[model samples]
Target: MSVTDQHGNIFSIFNDLLKADYGIWLWEPYTEQLYFNSHYLTMLGYSNAEFPYNIATWKALLHPDDANNIVPMQFKIIGSAEYGESFDTRFRMKTKNGDYMWVLSRGFVVCRDEHGKAIRLAGIHIDTDTSEAIVNKLAIQHERMRFALDTARDGLWDWSPATGEVYFSPRYVEMCGYQPEEFPQRVESWIERVHPDDIEATVTKQLEFVNNPEMGDTFECVYRFLAADGSYKWILGRGKVTRRDAEGKAIRIVGLHTDITELRNTQESLAHLINHDTLTGLYSRFYFDEKSRQLKEKHYPLSIIYGDMDGLKLINDNLGHATGDTLLKTAASLILQGTRGSDIVARTGGDEFTLLLLNCSGNAANLILERIQAAIDIYNTTPDVLPVFISFGLVCANENNTSVNKLVSQADKNMMNTKLKNHPENLAIIRAWIEKRLGSEIDIADTRLAQVHSSS
Candidate 1:
């Protein structure tokens, strides 16, 4: 309906009451006589005739910013009366105490002549402070929502099933590195980007809720989405089915989409640490133990090799701990490279490493051990602080007759024997190697060693 028809209905309903929360007045351009209800006079701190009674008088009471609009609208209502055009606008008008408050004014030309000219204008005013207060409240709520979305690194979206329209707030598009308008405005755009593995399952879950309408149908899931940059990002989607039609069909869904890429990355990293060693980046002892148990149960023949860096302590004391760590990692890498993909390598303890070889016989284990020794010899020839060599002890076992602890103990004994055979010449050489590899540069005197022995 036109503004004229709307205002006419309002005036017709309340004109007889002569009592509106807002002021009501009519001005005759020719006579300049203004007729105002008691409320109108009260608005200006005047009783009937107590003030100059005309359009000029009322204009003086308008708020400064509203005067410009009020003047033009007044003339429009007067001029457009023959066409039944009316004016409905909101402006600030001065109150009896000279304080200005918002008012909604609707004016119509009620009396028109045969020439289609306007003779008299009738209008009503409603104090819109209550309505204005409501609007301001909504505006504040909108601002708070905007702040929450911005600061929490969250995105928001609205989907209308009936129209097949999807609206994404700026944050939603920006998170995926796209302009707001660049993305398609359909649910298909969202569904098509979900990771293939998760898409069907996620859709099934969503459709279940859609088909069976529930007041609190909260759908939540995490899935990968193809970003505008062509990289896939993990997103945590949470939504509520907000609108359902009379037939109980879902018509709209509104919710938030948060980029959980970083969170997923952190989870993957933690998972890796849980199963793998932090230092050597090999399967951890826990993983080895679990896998060994499974392998034994499955009756798989496995060769277990336990090794320790032969001169780690000497190297650590002579060089630095950093060098010692480098040597350990280097040895671990070589051991890993020598093993088959099916085998597991682990850093079992400080200066100790272990390996589990699947389907490998004792002869095969020996061959691998020789290869590891050869790799160490080659590594030592490099100019950088040569990685101290590793000494390995192997125990071959199968489900027929095997014990993990017994095999490990046998390997440990062999490692001890190997270390003894390769011991450096003098205590000074041992101490020097330890200092250099272990970040400690202290040299112990023979007198101090004698003192320690005597004290013991």
Candidate 2:
């Protein structure tokens, strides 16, 4: 399948050109047998080459990009129930002199097995520029290009500004979930289907070249097109003024449409991953910092809260990391519930979280902290619930505070100070709970707890 549909049509076109070809060749797929007339070898500047050349030899002589294009069409014809389906394609063939010559190869499914699989193919190569077959060759080449475009599922648009008439290729209409006949053959029909937000930007670019043809012949833009499913899909649109008036106004504009929805969605998904925490669905540290910078520049008084789950390591070491992760999620939920919709909450690292509050005073920050603590208390009252607590630092900056780094430093220092006082007691309580819960199946070393406390 290296060569796709291209080689199939290429073979058919070349079959018609056999009337004025430079060389002839035959190949058997199953046996890998290959034959070429002396004129063929001489055409490729390989004079006096021995007989019995393998199909692989001929294939190896094909330009690398072309080999794949041929295989698809080759298999398509070979898989047919009928024989003698001709295909023609053009590709550069490597000559014995190491130079590449553009050769037109056409082949036919002359023989097929009982299973309808093509076994043998014979075709001719038209010279690069044969005077007698130039017209046929031109038409064939145009067909080849059209076939390739169809194979790619790309849509073409030809617009006549004066008449408001437009030709939308079948594939183009089909892509938008419309049957060719059902789709209007007018540019305005297309304009109506564009997403409202994107229509202005998309249409303006096209009109720029149409109104002032001197601006350029080509323009490309990405926009959303409404589909038949009532959904908008991303499309990369490219157009050029094919014909212009004597006064420099565009007459004909032709272009293509390529679906890029999947690509665009992938990019958006990656951006989300980069800016948000995977475990907590909160903003990531990078996002928080960037938001902080923006808020600072805009002269908003901001409160930065830095916190971490107390005894997180003790829970992980005693019960396993799974239990610890549950504790973290619970803490994140409580924190998110405590903050305003306008506030930004982020999981900066394992067991660590931050919150950004705009235009908030120190009292508002304390109120949010108190609300979070209340949530923790309510959860602790439930039977068999593991203890949840956070050691935190609250720092505030007004419009005049220009340095975010200093705010971060003061917040970290205050949170760590609270952690120093609160961690040991939290760890001890968690240890006792784990002992009773698990019947002392696990023991946590004080040294490890000390390392966790100091590291945080």
Candidate 3:
């Protein structure tokens, strides 16, 4: 029969069997002609009247990447009887909207010439773009997850409650100091390595989380793990319950373990630096303020002794800041030695120190001042280049009510008064003593006197 007559009969059969959801097409091999049913043209956002149904039009719509292989494969499959009477392939085809849609094309040779060369071919095209997009997206996601797990050196683990089976990635094996084959893939492998002291509580918490889905999907904890080196290392364990039973019990868990020993050590060092003075190794001003606030709420018998070095500027100006620093260090040591262990001593400023004496009255504070003086005298007798002298003022909290900050201010004012009264005379004596020892006249410009004159 003629090609048009053959197509009319084929269309009659398709009209009875094909649904509106499918796109049907026909091709004549000898003429290289193509025809698209109304559904096929409309599916591509075009009407049958608008689109020219021809081989050239169909080939132009094929995506460049798929055209080279799909076009050849389609012809080969129809021409060779040994291969198959029908063929199925997927490729991108352009839509009238100017975007490509994935199409699953299944074609069969419906007619053959006397020489057995296929004469008429028929096919149905189905839009599988959404499914293909989802599949490609999942493949990319899996590859990204693998790259992140490998490059971050993060250990990954999977646990199945039903089988009591555990899967450990290669990095997880190395994290625990074991080869992949050396470690058994069982839940107990991980449980056994948890430090004895922490395992019970950790497991208890894990069970609680599994039983209560409302708590959250995430589980995180920091605990010590026994390493292969026979030492305990701090680990930050993080995980999510990925699968759960109908009753909300966790059935599958995925997790990561990160070594956090260095991070923990850094945090502790930072805390220490925040609470103590780096130079004097004493409680810092920040710590002192916090302690004082706590003590103020109690209204206990507290005495604050505010002390200032008598000639620190003169020592720094004449001998150098190194000598001034030595003087400060010596004074700090003396204060620490004289104060009770329970007392809080802090270097609150460049030339000032404060001692917080708990459960101490004015009389007790006086005795502590005497002890500080005696300690300084002993230090001076040790043949030091510069004798250390500290002027002190002590104030006690009122029995009725007084804030610690108020007492601190009163004591500081008293200390300043005492310093102004005795500092000039004390400085002269110290300078003369230093000069006598060195057998020379040391010209030390008194910045304190200069400040007084300038202010006047």
Candidate 4:
């Protein structure tokens, strides 16, 4: 009987070791049988029902740039060369949602023929490198890394898998706020201090390094480790498999840790600044455009409302720019009050704004329009300030005929039409406000105002 017919349960061999916390794959070269755990499917945002578990199907999801390297390595792992018994590399694979993620793939040959040919294989796929900074943190040369580690308040750890013992550096005691005696010694003791959320990935990387001697000696992972205090600190743990048994299993591992909490916080603050408008606190145009492109592939309706503040130049020219800024801020506040919480309001330009209304119907769009006009009217009810007027145009888009560029063009046309329709009344309102403000200089202002109105 062929191995395919006889060894249906061969995939279960890896189950005892991994317990499904990580994504595992099993294959037999002679039978061409491939099996992947459900975790593997879930990691790529797919279900076995939706995705086939064959080499060709999986290869189709590999990023075009990665397929060239990944496919050849797959074949080489089970080839005639006994030294090529391990498969290791990083590659980008597509998720079910049409996005790509970088994953570290490592495999080992589990069975061989009498002639030392490979017959069966097992491996894991690790979702790593969630952030670019995570990868860049490991780029330093040996001397620079050692010098920095020595200067900074860093920690070191040494582990022996066979003896089940661990060694913690004195710096580790300082960083953890622990006494020398209280520092972790056994592997299990150290494992208890890792934050619950980070324990799985941290342990998996350790297993990956130990099991595959053919992979490089280096191992690195970032996780939150609990300190002697009640708090947890983000630690970048990098290590090397310093020794391996005759069977290629890891015997000793040693590494260092660097505190990265401040770096993480800074990155988060910078990210917020990138995605949000500094002046208005609303989403930026770049964020809006990015989201709009993502939504293009989804089946949903969107209401695009484009708006421009009217008479801003007039206000700035007559009053100071400070007054103009206040007017812009006031407009932004009223717009936010008029729209729903789910709506994405952005300051796209100096005097322009755009709102992306989600799942919005025609009635809902009309209601939003009325609410904004009401807000403007209520603001105008206050005395002494220049009247605030903003011209708006809207277009409803659906899956049938909608795209980012098309929606923008149509909304712009509508906005121009609305602006033309509102210009005369808005001009009159501005004229009234200017007449009221320029009491002593009315004669001089009249000439400039007349010129403005004529040219406008």
Candidate 5:
């Protein structure tokens, strides 16, 4: 008294009643004839009166490639012993206007003869063209997305909160020094691999993303990942919540992981350049000033010693600038060796350097300066080059007397005095003597400028 379609869709009830109100098409096996519901005819862009209205009538509407398969499948169904069983097939249907569209035809036998054989078959047919079109379009889109992801060279990760499952693409596993199966499933598995120092903050920030959903997109940070070989590498992780539940909780997170090792190295190199002298690899004048200021603020007693290479200009002019550079580096080495580990020595200018000794008195400064001078004396004894020497001036600063500018000026004045004491002639006197001796050979810049002006 009741019958249902193959997919459990109800069709007819109470032997005399037709339950299907929508368009449906059926074929009578005994007569090899076809009947279409109004809706089924319209689905094929046709009306009952305009169509062939027969079994062969529907074949013309099928796509050329699908016609062979659909016909064979129909024949198989009709010849089978299960006469009340339905048949399903998908093929292109020709409309009244001659346009073809994809459609799925499915139905079950509803009528039988007294001999228990199917005399007529009846069932409901749905317009499955829209669904098939959607499926095909989605398949194309998925393939395009796969190609993009494969070629991008970026690591991708997805996590499902409800299932506690994490999915990583092949590239993502490669970034963390692991094969796909080696990756752990829980969030802690990821957190555990982060460097210890960054682990707590990184974990806390991630939890905050869950607590405040608005911050989910901001959960980007740099952390160290433990490599397969037990070395740690730097990577940057950036993510966004791709799916959320009805409760506003994040159900899925999708993100990228980039190797930022090179970036972090570049940052460190830049910082070193900012804080260090390029030539001698010592602290620069800028760093010297900053460190001194910090020491002063901390109320530490600071002793500064200023020193200059003796005859540096003479070495440059006579022996060449290369010799002069070597002399400067030699002097810096002696200064570094003579001072305590806590002391800071910096090359502030050409042939000029200073040392800041923490908790050092005038006596310690004098001793360190004498040691540097002695080291220079020994270096000067090398057979190929002339003997090199350095002159120094020492100044001690306490809470009452210390300011970076004042301390430097005081040491500089003393350095000049020491220079004069050693050579008995200041730079002015030496310059005058050189000019007197080389007067005829010298091309005076002032006279040259004057002559150029007159010519103009």
Candidate 6:
């Protein structure tokens, strides 16, 4: 009889003996073929035709946690005689009803080649979902815990104080881009992976929590961990003492490590958005106000450089808003480049900018203003899309009682005076520059008329 006929006959005999409570399977390792009897199909809520009878199908149904650890052992048993005649393992297998059932798989090599290679294997599957054995209960609990951790993208860890040994779950090992055997099961193994800068603080906090149980029930910390690829990843570690000594010292702890790099980056981005101008990449008025208050508390010599763009409205009216935006961005870049990194450059209004210069006198302010003017001169020399011009006013507050607001107002008044004096000339220059750059296709008449009317 053919192998298929023989397997069918054997399956029929076992069906009578086990009364459908158990399932049988036959595998050909050389051919990578698989067979599941009718009882096996029925146990998983599927008919023989509904399920694909293949090794891949069998592997796909195995729980991920079990599969990672078991696949190699399965190969070792079939490929060598080290496992000694038979192998048995308990794992969760997905049923057709979308739930996992605990199963006990027992198998042995049924046939071998002339060279003593195991070509065929046979296994019996026993549903252990309701088994009363302690081992079975533990296996079921472990599978359930694995499901929860995998779903939450968390890695579980258990540490023993007595032996200094640590148990890292498969997911935990994989989180660091490591195989289960790659990472040693020791507390030092985990500590060694912590980034050097964070290790001291993390260890101190952990020790504090361990020494004082009354301080809190749970300990939490966030730090960077070195992954297998040699890159650091942000991890949030949280745990509680599950076992304690008579003196209330922590003896055993169970915890989880979660990858929080994305969340941390998102939080940093939100904080930047809150304190910075979205368009100009300068400090927003809100942040400027806060810094102003802080600088006022320290009685340092402070200088305020108030600036207004000369012809934004003219540009917006003749060219598009996009062109107007370019003018604002260029002004921002020039101010940033001209000022010291310590100086706070802010875009506080539509066409207005302010600089907070700490420990700067009026002489220092003048030099900065000169630097800005030089930058503008260079920009104008390059026949760019738009001509750049800015009116600036500087005021220094050295007195202990001098209010920042008063200095700001004085700078604003001075800036307005300069703007008024240069507005007419700046508009005429802009008109000529645009006409020269883009030719007669652009209209400068309406812009020039608006400038004259505004001056009137």
Best by lDDT: 6
Candidate 3: residue 157 lDDT (0-100): 71
Over 4 Å off, model 3: 1-152, 159-170, 176-207, 210-214, 223-234, 243-251, 262-275, 286-296, 299-302, 338-344, 357-375, 398-404, 417-429, 436-438, 443-456
Instruction: After superposing candidate 4 on the true structure, give the runs of residues whose Cα lies further than 4 Å from its correct spot.
Output: 1-153, 160-165, 176-218, 223-233, 241-252, 338-342, 358-387, 426-456
Instruction: Write one digit per residue (lDDT tens) for candidate 5, span 1-456.
Output: 222222111111112222333345545554344655445666666655677545766677678899888777656555654532566556677777777776655555443333344444554445564566655553444344333323323465667777788866666677757875687656766777888988766767776675566664335567888877788877767666766777667777766565666557877898899888887888998898888767644545668888776566755664578867876776677778777787889999888898888888788788888877777667656654444556688888766455777887899768766765664333333334335545633222223224434665
Model 6 worst lDDT window (10 residues): 1-10
Query: Regarding lDDT, does 2 or 5 come out ahead?
Result: 2
The regions of model 5 sitting more than 4 angstroms off are 1-153, 159-164, 176-178, 181-189, 200-217, 227-232, 239-254, 290-296, 358-386, 400-402, 423-456
- For candidate 3, write residues 93-141 as lDDT tens digits: 8988899988877677764443455655666666775476654553444
The C-alpha TM-scores of every prediction are 0.51, 0.61, 0.52, 0.53, 0.50, 0.59
TM-score of 6: 0.59
Ranking of all predicted structures according to lDDT, beginning with the best and ending with the worst:
6, 3, 2, 4, 1, 5
Candidate 4 weakest lDDT stretch, 10 residues: 1-10
Q: Give the number of the best model, judged by TM-score.
A: 2
* TM-score, predicted candidate 2 vs. hidden true structure: 0.61
> How accurate locally is residue 400 in candidate 4, as Cα lDDT from 0 to 100?
40
Estimate, for each residue in 188-257, the C-alpha lDDT of model 2 and write its tens digit: 7788888889867888767777999667766667899989888998887766676888888888877667
Segments of candidate 6 deviating more than 4 angstroms: 1-151, 211-217, 229-231, 244-249, 399-403, 441-456
- Of models 1 and 4, which has the larger TM-score? 4
lDDT of 5 at 298: 53
Better of 5 and 6 by TM-score: 6
Worst 10 residues of 3 by lDDT: 1-10
C-alpha lDDT of candidate 2 relative to the true structure: 0.72
